[model samples]
Target: MGSGLPRSIRFDERVSERLTSYVARHPGWSGSSAANRFVDEALRMEDHPGVIFRDGPADRRAVLVGGPDVREVIRSVKSARASEPDLDAGMVVSLVSTNAGVPARLIDTAIRYWAAYPDEIDVWIDEVESFEEQSLLAWERRQDLLAR
Candidate 1:
């Protein structure tokens, strides 16, 4: 991912130490790869004013600065959109903004993140849905045991 020649850029001593620590966090990532990813995330956050990337148990995700996870906001928007088919994409977001009680600006931040990385958000949505399904099944099994 370059214009050919490898380049060297200096950092503050403390910042260089921290970069090493950050590189250590990712098992298979080389220093260069991790640094590249970090720069990419910084640019993404800069591009989307109110969106930030966060680390989680599963992985890293884009989140609204003062709101819920971007995926959660997107899910709400999508569910609401399905019911209001006549509305265009923008209108459904407004409907979701009211229904979810999240400000439209925050929702827009998530929407922009979604537009940039829909595939990533969809993967997160699938993971949550799977977890919920497993929890429901576990609860039903416990209920059966209790009834007996």
Candidate 2:
């Protein structure tokens, strides 16, 4: 107690109040610990910037919308409810219709795929690709039939 060393910083009244709420929300974890962990992770990300957003290829159709980037979209999908199939459907519809500049009905199959696989957009893309391939094949068959 008689050592002349500096002491640790103490939480002020305002910080203490916020910490109390945080502690209540996350049981078994202290407010300071939570704050420290979040700050540490944020600082680590700053040190090594990951793919929060990347420039699309020169030939790719990429447009930033709603002031929210891909990372925010990913976060939103993660935090959304497990039973939110309709919400995921709407998201898929919006993305496909917006990107393809086609009617939503054309991308209904993609929406259904996304609804089934809410956490993964890869499956939805596969479904869209299959739909495109089938349409092209059908068009080619029709062209042959017309020439016959």
Candidate 3:
């Protein structure tokens, strides 16, 4: 989690009760922790309209509403930017949007989210790359075993 300033706020009785209930349902989460995560995700979603958080095997991550995960979008944009050195940022986004068949807004939204939480997205990217490398190596081992 990024270093965010802690602010104290008083919730109504009803909201407090709901937070308690949510904590009860989700083990290993305290009321304060749940509330903080909820508020953070709410703020991010409000700031980025097209971004949504989804749960995966690894963890919850920001993803486009009607497209792939934000990590994928950001990675695609990075690749595009690297390959098309002559293209401007806007043009690269447009090209990625066109090729991905998603609206330019979603692409922009992913970039915006990344700007807001670079550390979170970078961790996600690293985890995925590690997983991909592990899978490939396992597959190669299997192929070698079959050859033997």
User: Candidates' TM-scores?
Assistant: 0.83, 0.27, 0.86
Which candidate tops TM-score? Answer: 3
lDDT measured at residue 28 in model 1 versus the true structure, 0 to 100: 81
**Candidate 1 vs 2: which has more TM-score:** 1
Instruction: Indicate the worst ten consecutive residues by lDDT in candidate 2.
Output: 57-66
Cα lDDT tens digits, model 2, 1-148, are 1223443757788977887887798777766665665554456335433312224432111112323222223333444434345566577556545654644553443333334435545443445458779999999999999994
Task: Pick out the ten consecutive residues of candidate 3 with the lowest summed lDDT.
Answer: 1-10
Which candidate, 1 or 3, has the higher lDDT?
3
Q: Cα lDDT of all candidates, in order? A: 0.86, 0.48, 0.89
Judge candidate 2 at residue 69 and give its lDDT. 29
Model 1 Cα lDDT, one tens digit per residue, 125-146: 9999999999999999999999
Candidate 3 TM-score, C-alpha based: 0.86
Best by lDDT: 3
Tens digits of per-residue lDDT, candidate 3, 14-125, equal 9999999988998888877888888888898999998888888878889899999999999889889889999998899999999888789999999999998899898888
Candidate 2's displacement at residue 18, Å, is 0.5
RMSD to truth, every model: 2.9, 18.5, 2.4
- Full-model lDDT, candidate 3: 0.89
